[model samples]
Target: DQQVKQNSPSLSVQEGRISILNCDYTNSMFDYFLWYKKYPAEGPTFLISISSIKDKNEDGRFTVFLNKSAKHLSLHIVPSQPGDSAVYFCAAALNTGFQKLVFGTGTRLLVSP
Candidate 1:
């Protein structure tokens, strides 16, 4: 089963507005959630993460929210930028001895100028 899912294939946002990306998960064993940003040809870069015990986590202009009850996750990029335009992926992992992540299909965000 696809444990993590991103329903939206793409989204467009103005350069200064907030961009909201959403994701969902089906696995209760996932204890950690992470967001990654990727350029066209580059690998996904780690953005932010939230523990299963925490509802939200933030870093600079990026914030991630998690709802364990609903098995949902979201990422908010405030004041979106043209440079912020990229493919965003949400991932979930169970931390036992090692971290193995199940990633959702990426959502392409176009932060237009």
Candidate 2:
């Protein structure tokens, strides 16, 4: 079974600091990894992603790092603000054939002012 795990259920960070969310997967065959942020009643919105062939991908305030050998990945948010507080999910899937996304339990981030 392909399992993605986020051991931490929640995290608290002071505003204007950096927040790092971690995720580990059991499937080495997974080719794609993604992160999403969700608010109270709204659906999850895509954050960032990294391909298996690449180790890191950065976009604006978000950066995703993939360690293929460890089957681990992490998302880093710099200068976290109160508005950045939300539930974040980590997902992994194959990019070929019938692609199916397997999601982690989710980590809720609290950016405190």
Candidate 3:
């Protein structure tokens, strides 16, 4: 079974603080990892991604780290802002022709002023 798990359903943090979201996976065949951010009533937008061959990837305020041995991954948001309050989903997929992605239920992040 392909299951991506996000253990924390929600998180709250002060503005300019760091926010960390965690994810775990059961399928060992997943080779591509992705993170998507969603606002209310909007589709998820790709935030960052990493291939299984890499341990870490970063883009400005966001960074993702993968531990292949443990089948775990995490997203880190630095100096989070009030606008950053939204749901985040961690997804994984195999680089096959199907191109279907398995997504976690999602974690809601609240950044206070």
Candidate 4:
């Protein structure tokens, strides 16, 4: 079963605008949520993350928010640039000693000039 899902396959936003990406999960055991950005051929790189204990986390232009009650999370990029265009993946993990993450299909973000 797909525990994590990104409902929107893709999103388009103009440069300098705010880009919002959403994710939903079916598992309640998840305690950590992470967002990863993958360039064309490179591996996914960690962006921003939010723990279930907190509602939001921000790193520069990136911010991640988790709504535990709704089993949902979202990534917001302020003043998104063309260079920020990439595939974003949402991952969730349980608080168990062994860290195992369940990832979403990914959403391709296209930032246009």
Candidate 5:
């Protein structure tokens, strides 16, 4: 069974608006959260990450929030631009030390002008 899943396969938003992506994990052992952005023919690039100890972590226009009690995490992008359109993947791990990660299928985000 997939431990991490993104229920919404796609999302659309207008330029300069906020976009929200969600992820859920079945494994309670997960204590680290990571978000990645991937473009066509390109490898997924790390966007942001959060430790289970913290409720939220923000970097520029990207923000990641974790709810340990609910086993859920979400990514928020403010003022999304057309260039921001890409596939977003969320991964869960026990800690950042190891390379093992359970990744969600991915959510395609489209930003329109």
Candidate 6:
């Protein structure tokens, strides 16, 4: 079973517009959530994270929201730039020290100029 799922495989948006990516999870043990942005040839970089205890978290133009009851989450990018075009992965951890994260397949975000 897919512990995490990104229903949309890709999203395209114009530059300076908002890009929204959605994710859903079936595991209730997950307590820490993270979003990673990845480029073509490099590893994913930690973009933002939200703990299950909190409803939302933000950094710069990136924001993440967690809904524990619904087992869903989303990442929002405001005024997305061309540089923001890449693959985004939604991941979750159980809050244990090991933090074995489960990742979604990934969503490709294309920001056109």
Q: Candidates' lDDT values, in order?
A: 0.95, 0.93, 0.95, 0.95, 0.95, 0.95
Better by lDDT, candidate 6 or 1 = 6
Each candidate's TM vs. the true structure? 0.97, 0.95, 0.96, 0.98, 0.96, 0.97
lDDT of 3: 0.95
TM-score of 6: 0.97
The residue-level lDDT of candidate 5 at 10 comes to: 99
lDDT tens digits, residue span 18-112, model 1: 99999999989899999999998899999999999999998999999999999999999998999999999999999786888899999999999
Give the residue spans of candidate 1 off by over 4 A. none
C-alpha positional error of residue 4 in candidate 5 after TM-score superposition, expressed in Å: 0.3
Q: What residue pairs clash in candidate 4, if any at all? A: none
For model 5, the local distance difference test gives 0.95
lDDT of 2 by residue, 1-113 (tens): 53999999999999999999999999778999999999999999999988898999999999999988898999999989999999999999886776688999999999999
lDDT tens per residue, model 5, 3-93: 9999999999999999999999998889888999999999999999998899999999999989899999999999899999999999988
Worst lDDT 10-window in candidate 1: 93-102
Q: Report backbone clashes per prediction.
A: 0, 0, 0, 0, 0, 0
Which parts of model 4 are misplaced by more than 4 Å?
A: none
RMSD of each: 0.7, 1.2, 1.1, 0.6, 1.1, 0.7
Q: In model 5, where do residues sit more than 4 Å from their true spots?
A: none
Model 6 misplaced regions, further than 4 Å: none
Positional deviation of 98 in candidate 4, in angstroms? 1.3
| Model 4, residue 74: C-alpha shift (Å) | 0.3
lDDT digits (tens) for residues 36-94 of candidate 6: 99999999999999999999998999999898899999999998999999999999998
